[model samples]
Target: MNFVKRAGMSLRARKSRTAALLGIFVVICALLLGGFLLRSAAEGREAAAQRAIGVDVTVRKKGMSAADAGRLGALDVVHRYNPRFPVRAGADGFAALTSRRPAPGGARAGGGGPLAVVGVRDAGLLLPFSYGSTGITSGRGITPADAGRHVAMVEERLAAENGLKVGDTLRVRSTAGTRTVPVEIVGIFADPTRDPTGAAPPHELPGNVLYVPVRTARQLGSPGTTGEAVYRVGSPDQAERLHAAADTLLGAGSFDFRVNDKAYRDQVRPIQRVGAFASLIVLVIAVAGALVLGLLVMSQIRERRDELGVLLSLGERKWKLVGQHAVEVAALALPAVAVAAVAGQLAGPAAGAALPGGGSQHRRAAAADGVDATVPPPDPRVEPADVARVAGVGLGISLVATVVPGIGILRLHPRSILADTE
Candidate 1:
C-alpha cells in the first residue's frame, strides 16, 4: 500500500510526462484498431472470392472464329497441355430428353418449366463453368458424366420457386420452333441471377433458353456465334499481344468481334493493388509505432533524471529501477491493450461492412438466407475464433509498442543518473 501510494504521488507529480505517455498510447491504440480491422476484412473478402472461384482465368466464346484458335495456340506464353472447347446455345438436334413429363392439366404440370441451356462438348476444359449462389443455394455441381441426353441442373432458387427437385421432369421448349423435350432434374440450383425474379412468380422466363452441343449454337443464340478460342497467358501484360495475334489469325473480316481480358484484368488488378497498399500501410505503421515509443521512453527518462539519481543514491540497484519502471509501464499498457481489443471487436463488423466490394452485405445476406434456403453455402461471419485472433493481435501490437520505448531507457547508465546527485 505504501509503495502504491508513493507511485501514485510520483505519477501525479509528473502529470505532463504521464499525459504524454497516455497520448502515445491513445494514438497507437487507435491506429492499430483501425489497421487490424481493415487488414482482416480485406483478407477475409479476398479469401471468400478465391474460394468461390479457384480458376485463374475464365474464357467465354463471345468473339472467336476457327482461325483464332491457330493464333491462340501460337502465343509464346500459352501453357502446354492447356485445354479448350466449344460452348453454344441449345439446338433441337442436341436437345435430347432423358426424363418423362405429363401433358397439360396433368398432376406435375407445375414441374414442367423452361430451361436455360448451353451446349459444351468437352466438360473437362470448361472446369471454370462451375456453380455459385444467385439468391438461393445449390446442391452438388455439374459433373462430366452428367452430360448427354436431356439431364438438367436447375438453379435452386428456380427449383424452390417452382417446387421442383432432383429426379423431377421439365419440358424444355425451343423458342424458334415448337420443338419440346422432357429433361430430368439431375441437379437443382439456386441461381437468381440466371433465372427469374420479381412480379413474374420468380420462375417465369422472358424467353426460352436451350443448351445443345457447341456445333449447334449458330442456330440458337446468335447466327454469328461461330468458333471462339481461348489461350491462357502467363501474365496480364501478355493480354494485348495475345489479342493482336488472335485477330491476325481470325482475319480482319471478323475484327468486329470483341476480345475481353476484362474479367482476368479486373481480377488480378485489385489483388496487386491491395497487396501493395497493405504492405505499405503495415510497414509505415510498425516503423512509426516503434519510433514513437522509443522517443517517448527516452523523453520520460530525461524528465525523471532527478528521481533516478535519488533512487541510485538511496541504494536502489540500477536494474531494480529499470524493473520498477518496466512494471508500471506494463500495468498501464495491459489495460490499454485490453480496452483496445474490445474496441477492435466492436469496430471489426462495422469495418467489414464498410469494406469495399460489398463484402459486409454479401456476408449478411448469405447469413439471412440461411441453411433452410435450398441453395446453401457456409455463412461468412466473424466467428469467436476471429475475435480471439484479433484480441491476440491487438495485445501483440501493444506489447511491441511498449517494448520499443524501453530499448532507449535500457541504454541508460547508473553512473550518468548518479552524477545528478553530486
Candidate 2:
C-alpha cells in the first residue's frame, strides 16, 4: 500500500488516540484565536480615541496681530483657525448676583462678578461646543451672519437668573466698564461644568459664561486685545508639521505654539497596556501548545513502534514514513483549527467587551477636557484578517508539534524496533 493509504489506515485503527490529539488541538487553537482578537480590538480602540480627541495647536502670546492671524490661518496645515478674544464682561441683569454663601474669611458672596466673555469666529465649531462639553439648549448658535453684530449664546442658568430668553437683548459692559454692548441672545446652552469650587467667586461660575462674536468682543474690549489663536490640524501626526509651519511663518520667537493631545494620550495608555498583556498571553499559549502537542505525538509514535518497524522492514523510505505521519496529524488538526476559528469569532467581541477600562477611562478624560462623554465607543468585532491570522498560527503549531516528533522515526532500526516491541 502507498504511504498515504497506510497512514490513513493507521489513523482509522487508532480512533481513541486520534480523538485525544484532536481535543488538545481544539483547546490550543481557541486560546491562540482569543488572544489575537483581543490585541487587535485594544489597538483599534486606541486609534479611535486619538481620532476623537483630534489635534490642535494653541499659540499664546501678546502681540499676535491680525496679520499674524491671517498668516497662520492661510497655512496649508491649518484646517481651521479660531482667533479668540476673551474679556471680562458684566451682563446687565446678573451684576448684583452673589453666591448664596459667604466666603471663609468673610469675603463677599460669589454672585456679583463679571463672567468670561469669549469671542470666536464660529460659535458652533468652538472647542467647548465642538467637543460637546456645552450644547445649545434653545434657539441656534452664533453663525457668520452674527459676526460684527451684538449676538450671543448664554448659559441656561445665566439666562434663567436674568429672565433672558432667545431674542432678548443682553447689556454687556466690558471689564473696564468703558463700553457696553447690547448683545441679543441668539441661543442658550447647557453647561456641563458643575458648581464652582468654593475658590471661584459666584460671578465666575458656569452661569456667568457667555459666547459672543469675535468682532463684537473686539468692539467691547481694548482695541488690540488678542487672545490665543487655536489651529485645528487634521490628525496628531500633522500637529508637528503645522507647528513648524506656523513657527516659520510667524518668526521663531514671535509666539509659542503648544499641542494639546493630553486627552488622547491619557485614554490610549491603558488600552496599550492591555494589548501588551494580550500579546504575552498569545506567546505563552503558542509555546505551551507546541510542547504539549509535541509530547502527545511523541507518545503516539512510541505506541506504534511495532507497526513502524514492520513498515521499515518492508523498505519504506524514512522520509515517506514521516510524511505519512505529518499528513495524519494535519488532517486531524485542520478540522479542529476550523472549529476554533468559528469559536473565536463568536467569543472575541464578548471578550473584548469584558476588557476593563476600554471606555470608562476614555469617557472620564474626555469629560475633563470638555469633550462629549456620551459618544459611544467603537465596538470590538473579529474581522476576516483576524480569522486568517489565527488559522495560520494554528497550522504552524500543528506542523511544528507533529513534524518534530515524527523525525524520531528515522533513528529507529527495524530489527531493534521489532525486538523492543516483542
Candidate 3:
C-alpha cells in the first residue's frame, strides 16, 4: 500500500488517539479565532467612544481678545473655534410667564435670579451642542447672520414654562440692571438632562439658560468682558499635540488649556482590558496546545514503532514515512479547524460581552455624551483573514508535533522491532 493508504489505515485503527488530537486542534483554532474577533471589536468600540466624547480644548483666561481668538482659530490643529461671552441676566418676563410673583421688594421672583446668557457666533459649535448634551429642537440655532443681531435660542423647558415661541421677544436685564436687551426668540433647544432629578445644579438648570449673539452679550455687559474660547481638535489622539501647539502659539502662561479627554479614557478602559486579556489567552492556549498535542503524538508514534519498522523493511523511504504521518495529522486537524471557525463566529461576541467591565463603563461614557440609546451588537462573522491565520498556526502546531516524533521512524530497525514485539 502507498504511504497515503497506510496513513488512512493507521488513523482508522487508532480511533481514540485520532479523536484526542482532533479535539485539541479544535480548541486551539477556536481560541485563536475568538481572540482575533474580540480584539477587533474592542478596538472599534474604543474608537467610536473617543469620537463621541470629542477632542476639544477650552482656553480659560481673561482678555481673550478677538485677535487672540482669530490666531487660535487659524491653528492647523483646530477644526473649529467658538469664543463664548457668558453673562448673568434677569428675564423677569420669562419669570412672570412661569406664574412666579416678584419678591417682597419687587425684585424678580427667582431672587433677581440671573440666567446664564451665553453669547456665541454659532451655537452649534459650542460644547453643549458639539458634545450632543443639548440640541436644537425648534426653529434654528444661532447663525453667523445673528452675530450682531439680538437673536436668542432659549431652552425648550424654559420656553414651554414661559409660553415663549419663535418670534417672541425676551427682555433680559444685565447684571448691573443698567442695560435691558430685548432678544428675539429665534430657536429652542432641548437639554439632555432635562429631568428634575438630573445631576445639574439648581442654578445651572437648562430652563435658566439662554443663547444670544456675541455682540448682544457685549452690549449687555462691559465691552471688554472676556470669556473662554473652546477649540475642537481633529480627534482624541491628536488632543495633546494640539494642546502643545496651542501653548506654543499663544504662550504657556498666557492661557490655561484644559483638555477634556476623561470621558474617552473612561470609556476605552474596559475595552483595552478585555483586548489584553484575550491576547494573553490566545498566546497561552496556542503554546500549551502545541506542547500537549506534541507529547501525545510522540507517544502514539512510539506505540506504532513495530509497524513503522515493517514499512522501513519493505523499502519505504524514511521521509515518506514522515510525510504519511504528517498527512494523517493534517487530515484530522482540517475538519476540526473548520468547525472551530464556525463556533468562534457564533460565540465570539457573546464571549466578549460576558467579559467583566465591558458594558457598564461604555454606558456611562455614552450617558456623559448625552446618548441614552441601546448600543447595537457588533458583527459576529469571522473574517477570512482570521480563518487563514488560525489555519496556519494550527497546521504549524500539528506539523511540529507530528514530525518531531515521526523522526523516530528512521531509527526503527525492522529486526529489533519484530523481535521485541514477538
Order of candidates by lDDT, top first?
A: 2, 3, 1
Number of clashing pairs, model 2?
A: 6
Candidate 1 structure lDDT: 0.47
Query: What are the per-residue Cα lDDT tens digits for candidate 3 across 1-422?
Result: 78889889888988987888788778778888887787777766555544444456788777777667768777776666678877777765667223233334543334334577788876766877867777888899987778768999988878887788999998988767877889999999988764444233324665777888888887776446455887766466577776676677767777777776555455556667887887887788778877887788778778777777788788888888888888888887778879988898789778657643356666665666643224444555678888887888888877887788877876777779888885
Q: After superposition on all CA atoms, what RMSD does each candidate show versus the true structure? A: 11.8, 6.9, 6.8
Model 2, stretches more than 4 Å misplaced? 54-57, 65-82, 85-117, 121-152, 156-186, 190-226, 231-254, 257-262, 358-369
lDDT of 2 by residue, 1-422 (tens): 78888878888998988888889888987888788878888877666654555566778778677567768777776666687777666666545344555577876643323677788766755777766678898999877677668898888887877788999988888767777788888899998888665555655677777889888777667536465777766456678787777678767777787777765556556677888999999999988988898898798888888888998999988888788877787777678878888888788768778564456765676778754344344465667777677777777877888789988998989999988874
Rank the models by TM-score, top first. Answer: 2, 3, 1
Off by over 4 Å in 3: 1-5, 54-56, 61-152, 156-162, 166-209, 212-227, 231-237, 355-377, 407-419
* lDDT minimum window of 10 residues, candidate 2: 370-379
TM-score to true structure, per model:
0.49, 0.70, 0.69
RMSD of 2: 6.9
Query: Measured by TM-score, how close is model 1 to the native structure?
Result: 0.49
Tens digits of per-residue lDDT, candidate 1, 1-422, equal 23345555666777877676666665565555566556656666555443332222333354554334444655675531122332222223233221233333443323323344554433323323322233213344333344445555555544554576777776655435445556666654333343232223212342232223333332233333333333445455555565565456655445443333333333334544564565566567656765666566557767788776676667666556555554454445555555666666666667655544454444343234221112222233445554454345444544565465545545666577776455
On a 0 to 1 TM-score scale, where does candidate 3 land against the true structure?
Answer: 0.69
Per-candidate count of clashing residue pairs (backbone under 3 Å):
16, 6, 0
Q: Which numbered prediction scores highest in TM-score against the true structure?
A: 2
Better of 2 and 3 by TM-score: 2
